[model samples]
Target: MRIKFLSIIASFFMVSFVITSCLDNDNEVNYSPDATIRAFELDTIGYGVNYKFTIDQVSRLIYNVDSLPVNADTIINSILIKTLTTASGIVTMKDQNDQDSIVNINDSIDLTKYVNATEKNNFLVLKVWAPNMEVQNEYKVNIRMHTMVPDSLSWGDKPIAENPAGITAQKQKLVTLGDNILLFTQNSDKVYSTTIPAGSPSDRLNYGQSWDSKNADLPEGADVTSIIRFADKLYLLTENKKIYNSNDGLTWTEDNVLTPDGATVTNLITSFSNSDGSNHKNVNGIASVIEKDNKKYFSFAEQKETGWNITTSTEVVPAEFPTNNLSADVYATESGTLNAIVVGNTQGLDSKKDTATVVWASEDGKAWIPMEIPSNNNCPKLVDPSIIHYNDAFYICGKETKDDAKGFQKFYTSPTLLVWKGVDRMFMLPGILPPVKLEGGVIQYPYSEFSFKGKEANYTMVVDRNHYIWMVGGQGIDKIWRGRVNKLGFLIQ
Candidate 1:
């Protein structure tokens, strides 16, 4: 009886042990060998030309895990985020739930501390790891950052063909008349017209037929310096100080109303007219400073029933400027105000070069007052700068000497034309690298000189009615390129 009882006890103990082992096996958590990223999401945010991302905008890095088991002793060894370009510094990532804590699989990570405002075309990469696992898998996520603002300039696929053989192609000027763009050669009455291409408004310009010179009514061999449209007539200013008016580009009428007095008309601009319907005309024309008999004078012309009436103001020359050889480039702003930026060298009391640059502003284009321009370290001395009122601001494009060794072309913008700010180099036109000629007799790539003097003389830029900025024929350069200006005054793409 004692042996039977012992056998029964041993059997009962074995059954109890078997039950305990089964329970333990059933309750055991199966830790996945490989973890999976279910979803990686970034917050949608808009960007601008000069947008600086704040910490809150880029704080969230929401992600979901598929195979990570809850209540399991899964240890995340490290979480790293970096840009694909440098891959140098480890991005500072923190738990979104607890700002001071490190990032974890359960919580989203803050990514604001990692992003930079200056860097563009950037790709962000995230790498996560779980240590001491059987598989020891590393998970990764890649995201691309995009600019919310449209590019200022995007090159088109079509390339403008070279000028027909033997055609005298000098510097070209773009004059926008309604829907068509007229290209006039410097020092020639010949004009060529092009219509804006179909499709996107950002499409490249398409050249049309060249106009007959017989229809363009100007003196033979007259050098066309500047052109402007006022009211219902198109006016052309010649280097010899002659004004020609045309109802249609086909037939021009010489309006010899303004006697240039031997001073060449360098610029022509029309002021904004009063909209009260009280005035018969809404536009006023102003010519650049003209030199006559060794004295500089500002000329004004008004369209009337008979012809354009002219008036000259000798007092327009600022007292600080050299009375002789005074030259300037004039631009009319959207507000109908005229801004004259002195271009040539100014003379001191001793008749030498003056260091100060002068800028004058006028509403009526007759009475002018000097504007205060603050000195900026980034504002370089502009050489023969071209001013255009575009994108709600004034853009001055010219060359500047850097480190006194090399000179490069740059652009500056001013909201009120009183204070100017330089744009970043990344925003400038690309594909302007120095030219290289290949062995096949094909010019590899041609570049323009930073300075617009000597060999680079006649390098010019203009903005059309469509807000498309064009850099046309320069001395020894027949290449034409176009760009767009954003509302924020940034030249893009």
Candidate 2:
């Protein structure tokens, strides 16, 4: 009977122990002190995922490295921030108007008020609290946006620089040597060069550039039209089929560039620009050539350590290939095919008047092909044509063969390098328009589009490393204009 009573007492003690353990588990409390933000998620549809933000836990800062687009302000008021989770606590943002009171941020938070107060800068008063509300941590954020429509190009009232050559002469060529804009003037059958400070219109006006003439030993009658840069030296084909290279802008040296046994290079085409037209240096070029047997053909001028290694193409120059006033550029197609393109004036044998600007292309620099100009999409009869690969397309700018030389500028662009269309709005030139003048005592309205103000025959253009278009026109308007597409000139973008 005593043993039975002891057993019942032991069972009662065991049941009591189980009940005590259940109560302990039910009343458990967390005392973690760490409070942090695990991720700060931005709305993907609006921001487009490119505006990546970096979180600096040490400095307690969250900001984007790249300035947001111009439209960032569109959603600034109701910017959707999908969510901002925390490592701990009930996430809370200090009340914008009353900092003393806090608003619990459930799934999303409204930061527009805070952003406005701090001017888009994230002054993160964001706090993650421990569950007991005893410990807390704070973070700050910053936002940046572009001030203007980045892609729209704007040319401030006047030329960034004018009359850089400081010469009254009307026949010259503009070229760039690194940062310097050099103009080679035609002086008594000999060409002399002068360097001018080249910069944007945003730079100080009338840079008071000194014209340092580099005219010690320049070759006589060097066709400024035929001058092209290859490697580190500037080379020009003279009237007599002689090739001369210059180290300095002046001192000319005769480079015995070997052609085929009986072939002679007539014109130096152009050094190939990169496929994207961003770079046009240290590359090979093309040469329009003729054999001693009176055969017209083209050849390739390969880049070399010292000079060009001329490779004669087996094919003959097409009958329509331009003979003079030519501008050419070699570029790679998307599929990596090398295409050499040339545009110039072509006139019939008995016709004194020049025909429309003609275009020719070659794949291997040997076989030449003419791109047929459609009647519906015909180009102007340009006297002096210049072509360049820019903005994923080719642009051709030149003067018409019409007399007067006023309001005769023509600018055209081609995507497939086939159909040409006149450019407007974006490239319509303000610099090309004439100033309001008196017509029979009545004030005349300025025409919408025109060439640089002059009867200039010699005009040269270059797209600089920074993609600024530097144009120098000779004949009358001996001025230099530096302009760029607004976005291309942005510093921080």
Candidate 3:
């Protein structure tokens, strides 16, 4: 009887141990945080590019939501998307007469609202909301969230709507005006002012040079390509084939600097590639003006050489400037590529056009030799390239042309201009895939557009001290677009 009693106690102890172990395992497996994603489920949607948090169970929400790291109990009291979307929190659209069609912020088709377990794994609802704005029909909208928590941000997602049909192209031109009022002269000669302060449109601003309105005007039959204001002088290249230099914005002196012998195509002297007056010498127009180490640089198309070249000025005068060969493409097309070139003034890099790929250096800015890119990659193929320097790095913007008809904006970054490989910072901006069709023939209205589809060019980038990148379009109208790299990624300013 005593042995039996002892056995019964041992069995009871084993049962208790098993039950305790099972209970502990259950508790561990069901571990929950006071602040799970379910706490204050945030869902940033589009009225514009901003975050919209959906209040969950967290009564006292906490987050440092202004692009910094988010923490607990941080309240996102308000979010203002600097957009046309109304603050009433309702989405809208336009009718045939260009009137508003009201819709709930939670019901628009282009917009989406959702909650995430974290920023990573999220659930999506079928409907969305948008605002009724004119530009809303012109651009595609994308919204994403960034969280302080690791692996809490959303991944690659498409914009709410495909860009609608319209003339989204902005007329962009480079002009030097009084008091540094850089003007983007429209094709119709209508000037769109830039950040350059407005002052008298006098020839004295450019010294004695005349901005001969008719002389440096857009090609008689083409378009106004770009203008550069370097040093005290202003240079303008017209699509109709002319290069005009002016000491002031009003008075202009015409020079066929690139023309072989200054051939008069329709009475307008086209800028020649060489002094011999070669019509086929230069194909494209002069692009951006870059100044490095007290030297002024000009980028343009060298048609005869079948590539692009960069010319530098030892003096401010266009006449005294010595031209050097930059990068030349083996092929050329209207669908041609432009590489953005930025010279490092303090970066101690060399100044060769073809060898400007960062890794290669020419201390004197002339004689260049081939060097290996660290990645052993080929050079980038740029069509209509534009460049800007910022924060010790050169950012290049150009259009990547496919063998097919598709083209889009592409970018690259390097500490030096030489040794720029295909591998660099690459980004595609929000632009139309279809090219805008323009009118041809008479240079007067040569800038005509088709009613249907057209693609836009990548932007010409200019970086300011405030780190804002000012961009102007290539073939379209002159509208200035600003850009910057922000916490939410790249924002078109």
Candidate 4:
């Protein structure tokens, strides 16, 4: 078919008088052949067989010369030279193996059918149609063009003649953050960080063997829940519902952070050692942690036969208390209650970890007591907490959820450094909740970490200087899930 198409175009000029005259009057017409005349003429075919090719519905804008005359083709082989360059971005012969990402726009969209012998001389258009991408401002589309003759092809990237190319090339964006914030992502088993000064380009560093997916046992469906850097260690929470620990931000050692049962062997959730740098105990499901008065405290969600439970522990196991002393004051009365907790580092009257007024203390790991405060609705039940020592107060930050059927993350702050009961009124933070949506006759809500309904989970936020928040394991209907802030960040949006 291609051969037949070129033969017709070649014959069009066979009868033209200019060709015969140029040959006979070579001595008389000594001037060089006009470039414009040759450019407009169907003369040079790039040293190949003059196969017949049919060009259908050629648009007017794609002509070789400004004033080139258009000849009607009632099944003519020659196509009007659209651009000065003969390389028609339109691909003709595609390798069946060609998987050029450009050609893989929509699953149902067949790019093979778009391949053809000729185009009106224009690059193909690509459109994205995935349901998740339909409304997103940032999306990707794949496209592929076929170039048959190797020498005639003048493309930077061209597919082989009969085989299809791989089209799974995914697109990624380079994000820039302000000076105070450093951004990074975990690609496979390695951790990569790009630090951007307030207004400058990023300085990137890649740490090998820093993070592993097997550490957290990340849920079966999604990649990972969350990762953050706290203290000095590079911690990673995996989808496998486990926590991975690292010291130098390179090599890692993982331990069972959380078991399906409530038993734990470590007292330290995350520790910023004075000598060893940042590190976390090989424990899982702890959400957030913070330090104040040189002491560290951690809060996490654990599974129980009754329902989900939230508990807190200090980094050091006191000589008096050999076991991890969990505060007994706060407990969800019924099952199916989701809770998260984190210590706040902010400075205030009630912000000291050791000297705070009302402390939820337990001398022995067996007994629990909430001293100096009473439980009331004024105290918001926290689900996931981010505790930090900011300013002079030990701030306890957490996701305060509504007590009704659905659970959500509501940012709240408390200045009281004491136990859960003595804390000050819960004040909501400004501008942080995920947007909600109504789809498929159901109200779909956005969760920063776990989704009980959709069973989808994603973790955000950086854990200290190197670690990130990592959340793992959540059944579609709110079963077992353990999440913690780790050292590694994520790239998937």
Candidate 5:
């Protein structure tokens, strides 16, 4: 009878112990703070749905807690937010709307109200916390005044009929005449003009069936070197040292007064009053650089009441500009109130020894002044730099070589043509593909001439009114490509 009593007592004690353990387990709380506030989960109210917000619209910043553990009781109090302007190194703190006060989970903060008006592209740092003032997590948000990214090169339909000879006909010159884009072919004596249609995609070049070809008044087998627009007329300079002008791109009139005698007109540049009337005091004239009898001459033609008053300047003679050969590759453009010219000789052909690339600038293109090379350490020796004045700045694009191998193309921009800043290489367009190696290891692209020189020396780029960059035929390649520059100066696809 005593043994039975002891057994009952042991059973009762076992039940009591199990009940106490259950109560302890149920009452346990996880205070480890493993909850995360993901950046992607942050909600943006107003403006657009994307994480990127524009400064023009009012935006609300909030965090969603749906992804957190359901049984984890996480509490969020206040968010410490700060903004950093990208263009300018300016920092601002979030002070509006009692943002420093305590806030609950899913509470919102007005972001646009705290952002300064001078802030352009910016980044936001949001430090979230729990009710006990313990930091929860931090997130970064990108804000911009403009959301459009740069575009990549978008090739259009062949402006000309493909040559039956299987050779890609070279497009020697590309110029924007008013609202039309004029193209001059090296192998054909015709000029093709097209207009970009409105509402076209970034990768689409609107080469509508409205292509117009005019008989470029040139001798048979002569190639066009440069094309420019001055005084509401389009001018074409050819290899035969001739100048032709047309009020409309269809008709042509030879301007013999501006022609150089026995010299090839290698480059032509013109500056005019800005259409927006921002630069009304600037001169409206045309300038051409020609190589004659082993001499380089700067020819300036000032716009007159009726026609052009031509003047010739011999300041850039061969004695002063000692290029290897008289036929140096010259590129010219008008930047603000200055006319800048870039001259470089072909490597291994015209330049037997290493030569420094030269740049010259002039207000009237008569009294030329040499520009100092940029003092930046990263500024490499530019082989053949292409200069263009687009989007209120002068851009020089070229390639730098290291250990005899061509590096990716680089771009430098200057606001006043005096100081240059090397932009990031990401702003450069896609480079040409590597050429097939010949028996002697000579590199040549398909359908290209058997030569060692790369296409960097022969590229022609032009910027339209819309800031769309149009690349003409490069060395040994007749295909065309174009891309657009965004406000942030990035080149995007």
Candidate 6:
């Protein structure tokens, strides 16, 4: 088909040139054979032009290698050529009837009509004339523009692809290790993992490797729910009030940090990182809460060369502090400031008529500070919320118990951890999609947008090294999905 299309245009060029050169020749003078359109341009677009229009002489086509924004299609309807450079030839548009009109740089041209129509020359044709009076032949003009929103979050319909681990468990977590990500699922004291390979953060609908046995197991008393990554090692607290470290996610070893005196390990908070260059002895550590004498306290232990440097906060853990089903992580802001935050449930939220989720921040891991958020209807009861710092903002995803919304609804985002706002439009969850049916079969609504009737268990959202948002597993929905903002997938990012 491509060969046939090119032959037709080639024949047109040959016939047009032959007829003009074989004229009566009353003057017997020479005419220049050059009839090339050197350049063409519209104004700079919103995202700026990453590529310019390339004139392909062999294919007789003029196009932009990279696409313009979606509005560029409409913009071309009345857009004047801001720059049109030819080989000093008179440019004109010829019709089917052979009637022609001169084309000027200021004249608007509609490029969207009959674009991608290769079977015929039914679209507008811009011709360049040689020194002679006759015009030259066919050179199709094609401009490509994006069909999807550049910044809006795009998700797939439903699972037509393999669900990495192949089994849906009641709970799962995503852990990052440099270039790869691990999806860890626990069931009946047996834990499994699937490694997701790393690459560019483009439009990836499905991602994950086959499940492996991992060839490792946890200690008899190690808590699987409290495992966290600290610096280069994975740490978890055991039932003996001893903190254990593991170079790999499996095979734990005893560490120096213990739940001192008679306290038991409550839970692991998060890993705190130091990005401060001035601190020559830049240290990293893990934070946790321990209960002793009926009072819970914040505890942090720094990773040392030989042993661990433990520090327990003197301030008593507040009653409003999140205790269970917590999600936490450390992320750096745009200005290079590091932040460690934890968000979950506190027993007192049921008694309050305001928001249900609580947030706390820490600098050195030991001193915990509550970040105040607006107490309003915008903040829902985000039970088992998974918090992630992505694209410079923090996003919380979980089940909404307040109004009884379905499908893990409402992802709240905040630039500053203190102020959060529910995203009603842009960022949304993957909608439930049904299998495509025959001509007379029925399809479902909420196919690709957020669905309130959909069913998906609470899951973890982890950002990969390349910044792709990876949805690992829901208790009921064992699916691996990778998504990224369209602009973030651009080469500029």
Task: Give the candidate order by descending lDDT.
Answer: 6, 2, 5, 1, 3, 4
List, residue by residue over 1-493, the lDDT tens digit for candidate 4. 1211223433543444467676787544332222111111223233431322222222311122111111212112333322221111111112244322222111122223323313532233322222221121111111112222211201112111110111112111111122222222233332223332222111122221122222222222222223333334444444443555554444555645432234332332322122222213212233433233454444454434565455556454232221221111111112322222222112222322323222333222222233334443233433333443322233343333344523333322344444333231122221122335567666453333323222222112222232211121212211112121111121110
Q: Considering lDDT, which of the candidate structures 1 and 5 is the better prediction for this target?
A: 5
Candidate 2 error regions (>4 Å): 1-41, 45-49, 54-63, 75-77, 82-142, 167-169, 176-182, 188-216, 273-285, 303-309, 313-316, 347-355, 402-410, 430-457, 489-493
- Output the lDDT of residue 378, model 3: 34
Question: Judged by lDDT against the true structure, how good is candidate 5?
Answer: 0.47
Q: What is the lDDT of residue 361 in candidate 3?
A: 23
Candidate 5 matches the true fold with a TM-score of: 0.52
**Which of the predicted structures, 1 or 4, would earn the higher lDDT when compared with the native?**
1
Q: Can you give the TM-score per candidate against the true fold?
A: 0.51, 0.70, 0.34, 0.26, 0.52, 0.70
Question: What is candidate 5's CA lDDT for residue 384?
Answer: 42
Writing each residue's lDDT as its tens digit, candidate 5 over 130-233 gives 32223344434432222332332222223222212123435356667777877765667577777765543433344534456667555443444455666478
Residue-level lDDT tens digits of model 6 in 1-493: 0011223444666686677668854535555667777877776655555447788888767776566676667666666667767664466665444555556666566667744444445445667766544447557776655665777665555532344555565556677754446555554244445555545554443445345456456666665556787666777765666778777676678865555666777888887655322233354767888888887888877767787777777778887788766788777655555667888766755466536565788767788887774556344667677787776688888877654565576678887776678786667765533346567786533454333224557566667665667675555665666666666665433
Please tell me which model should have the higher TM-score, number 1 or number 2: 2
**lDDT per residue as tens, model 3, 1-493:** 0011223434654576678778786653221222222222233323323433333223322222333222211322232222323222323334345444433323223222221223533332111122111122211222233333421211112222111111234434443334433434344533333343233321111111112222233333223334454335555555554666667544567765543332321111112222212224233334333344444443332333454444433333132122221221111113332222222212222333332232222211222223344453433444444554443455554554456534443446555454453421223242322133557743231212311113445333444323334444444423334434442231211
**What is the clash count for each candidate, in the order shown?**
5, 5, 70, 100, 3, 0
Worst 10 residues of 4 by lDDT: 159-168
Give, for candidate 5, the lowest lDDT window spanning 10 residues: 68-77
Model 2 C-alpha lDDT per residue in residues 148-244, reported as the tens digit of each score = 5666554445665555555454455666565555666555333433333566533433332345544446566667777776546777777778778
The local lDDT score (0 to 100) that residue 447 gets in candidate 1 is 37
Q: Counting only residues 3 or more apart in sequence or on different chains, how many pairs clash (N, Cα, C under 3 Å) in candidate 4? A: 100
Give stretches of model 4 more than 4 Å off.
1-192, 196-232, 235-244, 247-250, 254-268, 275-372, 375-378, 394-400, 403-410, 419-459, 462-493
Worst 10 residues of 6 by lDDT: 1-10
Quantify all predictions' global Cα lDDT against the true fold.
0.44, 0.59, 0.34, 0.28, 0.47, 0.64
lDDT per residue for candidate 1 within 143-168, as digits (tens), equals 22223234343333222433221134
Task: Give the clashing pairs for model 2.
Answer: 122-141, 122-142, 124-139, 124-140, 170-475
